[model samples]
Target: MDRFRDRQQAGERLAERLVALGYGREPQVLVFALPRGGVLVAHPIAQRLGAPLDVWVVRKLGVPGHEELALGAIAAGGGRVLNEEVIRGLGIPAEAIAQVEARETQELLRRERFYRGERPPPELGGKVVLLVDDGLATGATMKAAIAAARAQRPARLVVAVPVAPPEALREMEALADTVVCLKAPPDFRAVGLWYERFPQVSDEEVLYLLRVS
Candidate 1:
């Protein structure tokens, strides 16, 4: 496919692919989406697979003075992953990393509260967990999510996305039990580039999708 019309279309395509791969047949399937964009993309997957949907809140830890550069990421339930190579190469101090992590942790907690409210988190133990995201760029946030999900002892961990660069897909393959990606274009620039009508997903949209799902 050249490009998806939007996140919904991309999600429909992914859901179809997953069904073909026999994921729809899996009995104890649970879908966890990374908000706020991933939730929209995962809605169709959850519907197609007849699974419960939940959010896995994660926040990226950007490098000091260069926010775009990801130093690592943190997930709900206190799961975290840091790139020692990046920290060592950039000579980032522990204090700076601590400060960034603290700020992100607060944001993660806020999202968990706002998106989930009083709803208890899904039970992942012995369930086939399909962790869905809109797409992967650096894969830092997804890695953190995987780490968090692993702690819950899911029977199988699958990372699914609509589009990603080849290198990012390869990295994810090593982390999760299975990785399903629809398109891995060689000239991949960004996740938004793979969708023609990409737009910023708002908190309101996230709330609506979660409520319906």
Candidate 2:
């Protein structure tokens, strides 16, 4: 089982792969990290690719009782993606889904303001946009991010992550023009399990990386 020492190491490895694939050679490239974990994973990629780094804030709408189980996700620019399978399988009602979306939407907006401050989002039209995340489990959040990026009419939308389950990777491939995942273990259970040290990223760290990049 391949394991990453930390998010930084994972980001370095992903950056190497991106460079090998002829990325980072162009000026019309923009990298969007899904904070606060994705910010660290994306920093190295942005640095190596010489791409301007930014955050695409998205909030996972967890099920009311089971907060870890993602019901859907809402992103900045009013992009939302719902898991119909999960909602129908759990017999969740519209009222419940609406409530969850409402709560997460507020947090998403708050994070966008807090992280971005007065800086306007970059122009994605006709640019190669890379959406980076630490890892993916259900991929709901990345889906929302992709939807938001697609609305902006990027020339190409790429989904990059260090590790993800094969099923989740397949789902992302359908949404993005290209998917760059370092590891897709079939028996993958959780994103944290593949890492030696997976800690919750703080807002301060996210702000620092954004400022530096």
Residues 32-148 of candidate 1: C-alpha lDDT, one tens digit per residue: 999989998999999999888889999999998998999999999767999999999999999999999999999899889999998889888999999999999989999999999
What is the Cα-based lDDT of residue 91 in candidate 2?
Answer: 97
Worst 10 residues of 2 by lDDT: 102-111
TM-score of each: 0.97, 0.98
lDDT of 2 by residue, 101-168 (tens): 88888888888899999889998999999999999999999999999999999999999999999999
TM-score of 1: 0.97
| lDDT, residue 90, candidate 2 | 97
The segments of candidate 1 whose C-alpha lies over 4 angstroms from its true place after superposition are none
**lDDT of candidates 1 onward, in order:** 0.93, 0.93
* Residue 35 alpha-carbon offset, candidate 1, angstroms: 0.6
**Candidate 1, backbone clash total:** 0
